[model samples]
Target: MDNMVSTCPICHQPTSPEWYFCPNCGKELKAKLIKIPLITQIGIYALSIFLPPLGLWPGIKYLGQKSQEAKMVGIVAITLTIVSSVVTIWLTFHYLQSYLAIYNGLLTNPSGLSSF
Candidate 1:
């Protein structure tokens, strides 16, 4: 197949697969895409769940890419990051509120204290 030459659809000019454009007509000859592996996608998702900040980098990076699949992965990663972050923030606030309530109770009830 190395001896075979592919032709440009627009200008019907012979072109090489390695060439990005047709030399004769200047028409684009090859369409290239940045492909991300499934394993890497899973890794990014895991990071998004447990470590959201780390996951955000790949999410934004993939979103900027021209590939549809990469965009999907990016969207998933970002979504996971947002969801996880929201949950984490909510839990932190909830625990803080609980701790504050306990502290206030201890402060108001001086009679219940025993010498330690």
Candidate 2:
């Protein structure tokens, strides 16, 4: 009563500390704060490194959030991941079985990997 601060919009009674909506009238007294999990943040970051599609999960979670920065981060990260994956795949295909055979090292050829 004495230590209480503002009054509830509806009831007009004393409001508690940092209460969002007025308990009596159900009026919003404070702004809503959206929170994202740290794991999601880190996961999105990792997703950025691999494939953007892989990050779609976390990106959807943070989509249209109050924090535009986080959305941007997710978007950029995902894009990079996808691009990197594509580039890596392209290089692997360009090299084809030549590198595979060499890396595997088979006894038939100097770098054949049939035994492996």
Candidate 3:
């Protein structure tokens, strides 16, 4: 097996590529970069913006992976999903309350619409 070695920027010490922090300096190591296709990122963001709840599945999946970009997209997707859900629920409740008010008014005065 090949032991890959890397230099730490903070301590200027040799460290293993797999190490998460520098042994000598205790500085955090940079995560290995994972390249994701541009199209995939766009698609993920598009789904997140259009269908936030559905997008959360992909977001959570990516978040569990090691890719930093994927994790970022996942966070954004989760945020958008929560915001969208809140707005939708608020709007639905508001509209339902308005509908109930109209229904109650009609029930209280059946002749209310007779003039119309």
Candidate 4:
């Protein structure tokens, strides 16, 4: 069983690669951004357009992180959510208005369909 371990620079204590902070001295082990691929970004943005609530997960996740790029992505995600919500609402209202007009016409004259 090869149990290889690395030492922390600050406290000379053994640390595992997966550990972000040195357990003995609280030294930061590694600082890196969790990268998101371009395809995934496009998918998230697409989800933002289709299923807005589902799309908000990435934005909320990135916004709470401590990276500038992540924050920017989060801001963009939230903006897309807002914009999509507004567009969805507007489209719903527009369609509903048209449907109600047709329904009212049907109520006024049930025999109008035979003319077509």
Writing each residue's lDDT as its tens digit, candidate 3 over 4-82 gives 6678888889988667789999987766666668888778777776776787898898888786567887887778778
Scanning candidate 4 in windows of ten residues, the lowest lDDT window is 1-10
Inter-residue clash pairs, candidate 3: none
Off by over 4 Å in 1: 1-35, 114-116
The candidate scoring highest on lDDT is: 1
Off by over 4 Å in 2: 1-32, 35-39, 97-116
User: Which ranges of candidate 4 are over 4 A from the true structure?
Assistant: 1-32, 110-116
What tens digits encode model 4's per-residue C-alpha lDDT throughout 1-116?
Answer: 32357789898888886677888889887666566677877887888878899779988987887755567678888889889999999999999999999999888988867788
Give the RMSD in angstroms, all C-alphas superposed, for model 2: 10.4
lDDT of 3: 0.79
Residue 59, candidate 4: Cα error in Å is 0.7
Lowest lDDT block of 10, candidate 1: 28-37
TM-score of each: 0.64, 0.42, 0.60, 0.63
Clashes of each: 0, 6, 0, 0
Worst 10-residue lDDT window for candidate 2 reads 106-115
All candidates in order of TM-score, best leading: 1, 4, 3, 2
Deviation in angstroms for 60 in model 4? 0.6
**Candidate 1 backbone overlaps, count:** 0
Candidate 4 TM-score, true structure as reference: 0.63
Residue-level lDDT of model 1, residues 39-113, one tens digit each, is 999999999999989999999998988765788899999999999999999999999999999999888876646
Decide which is better by TM-score, 2 or 4: 4
